[model samples]
Target: MAVVSACIVALSGCALPRSGPKDDEILAGSKAEGGPVNVVLVDNRVAVASYLDDNLSFPSSFTGAGLASTDTINPGDVISVTVWENVDPALLVGPGQKQAFIQEIQVDQAGNIFMPYAGVLKAAGNTPEQLRRLITRKLDPQTPDPQVEVRRVAGDGSSISVIGGVGAQGVYPLVPSTTRLSAMLATAGGVTIDPDVAQVAVRRGGTTGRIFLQDLYDDPRLDVALRANDKIIVEEDRRTFTALGATSTQARVPFPQGRMSVVEAVAEVGGLNGNTSDPTGIFVFRREVQSIANKVTGRNDLGENEPFVYVIDLTRPDGVFLAKEFQVRDKDTIYITEAPFVAWTKILTATSQTLSFTADVVRVGDLLTDN
Candidate 1:
């Protein structure tokens, strides 16, 4: 009995199976002690405020332009010019005909369009009305009271391309009604993915900007005015976080909505395991941005993408509320450690099973001897 007890004690000293490191072990390995990660205690309002300030939003200059209007002519645009003269024989019209139609007149690269008798005229940067007066003046010397009408036609100069995760993917003309970003998206059949998880990216010239699709709806300023030749892409959010350790489920969970808090993320993974999780040992592992790390750690020695582990103790008075306020970013890892007693429980259960098996063997030997 003494030998068996000694063996059981020796086995208990060995490492037991655990889902992850305990709260104390995580603290010991933090960057304060020259460890791999920086440990942050998110127990006060200041800590929560630091993370809340880091949000995803579009640049202020992105929305500076208001709604777009497709009235002025541009290079590569096609316009039709009609000339009407009351004279029996006009310079622009036929000898017997009173009117003549110059169809499919496209604006050249230099913003100029040529007519038969009016010579080369500037069309780009001028409205249809402005171009009409110019053409009438150019032909007034050759034909008296010559009337000219300039009408813009379908062309590639004033159009945008909408693609990726939309109901329709094509180049849509920017008309008077569908010139804004949201209106153009609607013209392309809106977005096919859920608005909460959709991302909108706009590329114009050499600059580009991105924002959440929901942000475009919640804030009117985010819906900037569209421009000609702008390329818009709508796609699903690819950001994800890994849930491990004693949680009810361990997997890579996709963000269901924008601006997800720590509490919401834990709920997404089925919360912590009631049988084994330590409420005080919930940890979020991530790489903090350099600027944010400097503010959070109160030091400026950190390099870019500093390794960070944010600790949350739900057992504390303000732990749950703090977790509710703290935001979780992309590629973060949430780990919940098992309770300390759970290890002792497993050891005791194993010891008891070993003793029970030994007793059963002794009882069988005694019965065999009696037989």
Candidate 2:
């Protein structure tokens, strides 16, 4: 019995240590020596939901101006020009020619269109109405009181390209003054991934901007007007957070909707291990921007720019509400410290299994000796 007790002590000593600082220890250290990370203790009295409401906001992509209806002609756009002369005898048309003479012309690479009497007229940058007035003026001397009309038959050059994570990638023509971001996406058969978590990127000229698809739907202002030559791309939101320590499972979890709350993140990783996790030591480690960190910690004397550890004590009922309000950002680390008794429990379980196996071996030896 003495030898067995010694063996039990030795085996129990081999158990893993309960690592990480305790809640009270961390708080005590913070009061004594200031650390790099600003540890914010969350409890029932803290207004976490209100803080999130004040700080977190969806980006607005709406420009001040409304959609412009006047679409300028561009190279490769097919246009039709029609001319009606009132005079009985005309140079281009025969005498008593009441029928209008139509000319189908495509804007050349030089941004000019050819007409019978107008010669080479610039059409790429000018609107259809503006081009009509110019052509009518040019034909004034040749044809008496000439009525000229310019219309775009096909707008191939004025099209937006939709690609990446879409059902069908193709070029969609923009209707004059009508096409918006949502319209272009609809033309491409919508995004392949869930729109709530997907990122919609629009590249125009030399600048590019990206916003969550959910933001676009929530705020119509984010669905800005689409322009010709704009490239729209939809992609899955790859934001993720890692669960470690005493959680039911330890793994990296993706935020499919681009946003996740602390409670949801915990649930995603199979929740905290009931037998091993320390309810008072649940923490979310996040490296926030300096401004945000300063606001959250309310401390300017932080030693380093290390990540802040927001501690949540699940032992209290208010902790559930706080966790629900606490939003989890991308690349965050959620750790649940082990309970103090967990190591001893593990040691006892291991010892019991070992002793049971030894008893079975002794019983088999006794049976063999009797035989």
Candidate 3:
């Protein structure tokens, strides 16, 4: 997931440059209108660090018809019976009498439920209403009419857990018929920005399955239903920003879910130091090029692929202008070298230019001879 995100940052960082500044005045005007991008790595700033954690609600459509056929009943299920002709005995009555009125059913591992005169009947594959009918038929010989309602009491109809930025960390009950992963996240209060919607994982019976959260929004089918004992883990979009040389502060800034650009990262670290900052040395070291190259060839080794590292020179008058628009990536290292001699060079150039103009107009012999 991080690899995919990093590729996006690298691709977005290098948008074709616009036409050079028409004039100093135009450059100045553009500079004033647009400030340099402060795309710093996410650090302590919660606003910049946090991503949106959207909770999906229980889908209204995952009903009885959506569930697949399965034969699996669990214990600890609660059931109630309406006896058409049995006498109602209070709990305070003789223990035997009270026990006769209530039958606490327990299903064995074999997927069978115990009921009066029913011995052990298969209840796993049957829905509550279906189970009720099955039990009713079994008791027909003993009782003229028997009404039964079997429902889940302690087990998930089908569930998956949500951890890392979720409101709660327990298993979310899925709609028995067709509860999807999206619905489970909703039931658990969705994910937090810190744990954005990058990837949604579902662990089922020792096997783990994953689906992209964004895919759910694009294709509703991706919000696959949750199954028993499935676990869902969400990863934040931002993790590590690569650090580069010479900047007073060089460290990975943490970002929440979602991607940020190189310029935005610069701002995140606070505007560059006017004295030590060299805009040209600023770079975004990315591995996307190599990863893509490796994929087609089925090679795991880094091979001949070169990680793209963009080095921007801020020494130019207009360089500062582009930094504001360049995107940043996580774990990006920004290096700034002090301006190599711009101050002295500019002063010398101005003085030399003036001297040349004076020499051209008036010969040195003219002043010396007159004196």
**Of the candidates numbered 1 and 2, which has the greater lDDT value?**
1
lDDT of 1 by residue, 345-364 (tens): 87877788878887999999
Each candidate's TM vs. the true structure? 0.89, 0.80, 0.55
The backbone clash count of each candidate, in order, is 0, 0, 38
Relative to the unseen true structure, what is the C-alpha lDDT of residue 6 in candidate 3, on a scale of 0 to 100?
51
List lDDT for all candidates, in order.
0.86, 0.75, 0.51
Cand. 3 Cα-lDDT: 0.51
Can you write out model 3's per-residue Cα lDDT over 133-240, one digit (the tens) per residue? 887788666655554555554454344567865667786544543356666776777766433436666665655655456656666656665555567787654456
Best by TM-score: 1
Model number with the top lDDT: 1
lDDT of 2 by residue, 1-371 (tens): 76467657988767345545555655654533575455777754443521443222223433443674536888877788778778877756777775565656888878888887789999999989999999999999887788888887656778788999888998877775347888778778888887767888888777677888878778777778876788998888778899988888888988856667778899988888888888888888777665556555565654434566778887787878888877787788888888878767767777777778988999999999999
Candidate order by decreasing lDDT: 1, 2, 3
With candidate 2 superimposed using the best TM-score fit, by how many Å does residue 275's alpha carbon deviate from the native? Answer: 3.9
Error of 1 at 38 (Å): 2.3
**Model 2 off-target regions past 4 Å?**
15-38, 44-61, 85-104, 108-110, 303-305, 354-371
In TM-score terms, candidate 2 sits at: 0.80
RMSD of each: 2.8, 4.2, 16.0
Q: Tell me the lDDT of model 1 at 207.
A: 85
User: What's the lDDT of the predicted structure labeled candidate 1?
Assistant: 0.86
